[model samples]
Structure formats: C-alpha cells, structure tokens
Target: MQNDTPLYQLDPTNRFTHRTQDYDAYRPTYPSAAIDAILEDITPQTVADIGAGTGISSRLLADRNLKVWAVEPNAAMRATGSKQPNITAWEGTAEQTGLADNSMDLVTSFQAFHWFKHNDALPELQRILKPNGRLAVVWNNRDRTDEFTKRYGQVLQSVSSKPVGLGRLSDATPIRQTNPYFTNLREISIPHQQALTLEALIGLANSRSYTPQQGAAKDLLHHRLAELHRAFANNAGIAYLQYQANIFLADPA
Candidate 1:
C-alpha cells in the first residue's frame, strides 16, 4: 500500500520488526479456494513465496505438500515463520530474491506486491519462474459494503497518513496497469471472513504498516477501534470481518 510517509519518513524494511507478533497472531490466511484458483490443474513441486510475512501463505502451500521457499526480508518475521515444517524461510526481497533463474514452478506474493518496486520485482519474478510458470498476487480485501466494514475503512483512513490500499476490494486494475512483463492476467475472488476479538481487532490495526504506532494518533485509533468493537462485536466477543480473497494469476510475457 502507498504511504504518505515520504521517502525520508519511511523505514521501509524495518517497519515490521516490532509488529512481528501482532502480524503472526492476528493476520488472516489466504483461503484454499483462492489457492486452487492459482494452481488450477498444474502441480508445482517448488514454490517461492516472496514477501512472505510470517509464512501465512507459504504454510498453506507447504500444507499441500509443496516445497516452499518463504522469502521475507524481515529477520523477525522469518524467525517466526521458520518454525513451520517444510518451509525454507530466509531473508529475501521481491526486487532481489537471489533464487536461481527458472528454478521455481510458481511464484507468489500475498498481500505484499504493493510494497515492492514492481519494475524490478517483476523482472526478478520472471527470471526465477520456469517456462510457463505462474505468478500469483493475492490480497484479502475487506468487504467494505458491510456497515462495520465501511466504518473500519473510515477508521483506517482517519489514522493513516495516505490512502490505504490493501483491504479495499480490487478489480485488478492496478495489477493490470503495472504488469509489463506478464500476460494473460486472470483474477478470481473467493468469499472469506475472519472472527476477531477485541484484542485481535487491535492487533489487526497494529499489523498494518501505515497505522500510527505511537503518540496521539495511536491513542485515537485505539479509542475509536474500541468503540467500534463495542458496537459491532457479536455476543461471542467477536466481529466477523468479511473479505474477498482476490487472486491475480499471470504468466511471463
């Protein structure tokens, strides 16, 4: 997601260090239905998941019995994800994965593509993907049509310095516009939802890079979110955050 924090204010790589726990604890996982849409009839033996925060999507791929290379630049996140069996977690960025050319049958970036310098990352992805290999970019976009969901967007925007992009329902317009090295762009959406407790809801807010972490903004965000939880949370102390898992699949052009 684009941030208003200019090149000077943004730490870029180190932003997620303190957020590792919240990310691992509260971040949602991609649906199996979305994964199936990306894989289709193909059977990939090796999959490289770039910008794999906490290995959420990587674990999903590994659970399908595929060898997963969980490439993440953050040491803290990589450490958390490495504990998962069948995942080779390591430090890597989308712009420079350092994987062998034509080595991977499939490459994916889940909720991380927007953070990458696509001009460089696309070529790098294209280089690593084998002939006819697929590249998938996926996001769990919040259902903003719901009243609570709309309120959540307002909360995020109120706190965020710039326009928040990840949770918004995407039509793949940005992906289609930015993709120069890939062709046959295909998109699929799978209905999904997550049950978040008050604490988890706060954790979800903290998990975002753009969310203010300290000072008055932080206090205000928390106060407003607590209010939201009070009004929208179910009897079980949970709020169902609806989402549509949007998957964009393409091949090297």
Candidate 2:
C-alpha cells in the first residue's frame, strides 16, 4: 500500500541498538500455524528473512528445518540474531542482500517490507528467489473493533498520529494492484490475542518506531497510558489485547 506520508525513517546504524531491549521484550512472536501455512505448498530448503529483527520470524522458519539467513540491515538486530545458533544473521538490506543469486528458496518479510524501497528491492527479491519460489509478507495489526484494542489504539493515535500514517486496511488493495511479481496473492487472517498488564502494554507501545522516548511527549504518553489502564483494567487487572495477523503470500513469477 502506498502512503502519502511514511511512518518512520529509521537510521540504519542506530535503529536496532536503540530499540533492541524493548524490541526483544515486547515484539510478538508469529504463530506456528502462520509459519506452516507459508511453507505449505513450497518446501523452502533455504530462506532469507529480510529485516529480520531479533529473529522472531526467522526462528519460526528455522524450527521447520529450513536453513534461515536472517538478513538485517541494523547491526544490533544482527547481533541479537547471531546469538541464535539456528539462524545465520547477515548484515544486509532488502535492496542489496549479499547472498548469491538464486540461492534462496524463499524470501520473506515480516512487518518489515514497508521499510523497503520497493522499486529497488523487488528486483533484488526476484533475483534471489529460485523459480516459483515464495515471497510472503506478514503483519500483526491491532484488532481495533474490540473495546480494549480501540482504547489502546486511541491512546497511540493521541500520542503520535502523524507517525502512524494512513491505516493499513486502506493500503492493502493498492499494494496488491501495484506489485506484479506475485500472480496469486492471497491473504490469511489469523485471530490472535496478547494478555498484558498495563506496564506490558506500555512497553509494547514504547517499542514502536514512532513512539517518543523522553521529555514532554513521553510524560504525556505515560499519562495517557495510565488513563488507558484505569479504563480498560478487568476483574483480574489484566487487559486482553486482541490482534489480527494478516499474512499475504505469493510466488515470484
């Protein structure tokens, strides 16, 4: 999906280190079913995860016995992935992956494709993927229809509406239209939930690329979060945060 305003332009060097701790703490791991679905028709002997932050998705693929190359441009993220023996973390971007041509059986991006310069990255992906290889993109987005999720989303918008940019729903159709490499693009909507205390919710928000870390904005964020906690707290004092995992899968034509 094409957005008039970009969400966040991260500095490649500082991006991973600055957010590493929070990212490792708060980022949701992909469901095993999603991974299985992605690998169903195509048996990927070797896979490359572009923008593989902290190896969340890479680890999932690796668990399926796929040799995973966790390709991340950010140094700190690569460092984090290096600790995992299953994944070989490489420092690379989607546009210029250092891996040899036609070496990858699958090229995947999880919540990271939006960061890529598509014009440049598309050809790179095409080059790396073997014939009829799969290209899958997955995003876990808030299920704003639920009351708790709606309130949490409102708090996020109140904090930084500018950075959130246009809604993901609006962009999906256009993305399908513009990208010609994928012939049979299909979406799999998976229902998911995260049980969180107020503190955990705040940590999740803080891990986002657009969230402000300090000063008046940070104070405001905390204040709003407090209100959100008070408003959404349940009998057990924990909120059930609902999410929808929207996965788009296609083959490189």
Q: Highest lDDT: which candidate?
A: 1
lDDT of each structure?
0.83, 0.77
Stretches off by above 4 angstroms in model 2 are 1-3, 6-16, 164-175, 178-180
Question: Which tens-of-lDDT digit does each residue in 59-176 have in candidate 1?
Answer: 8999888999999988888887445567899678888998999999999989877677666778899999998899999988888898887898789889878544443334455458
Give candidate 1's TM-score.
0.90
Clashes of 1: 0
Output the worst ten-in-a-row residue range by lDDT, candidate 2. Answer: 165-174
Residue-wise lDDT of candidate 2 within 156-184, one digit each (tens)? 77777445443743234424775765557
Checking candidate 1 for backbone clashes, the offending pairs are: none
Pick the TM-score winner: 1
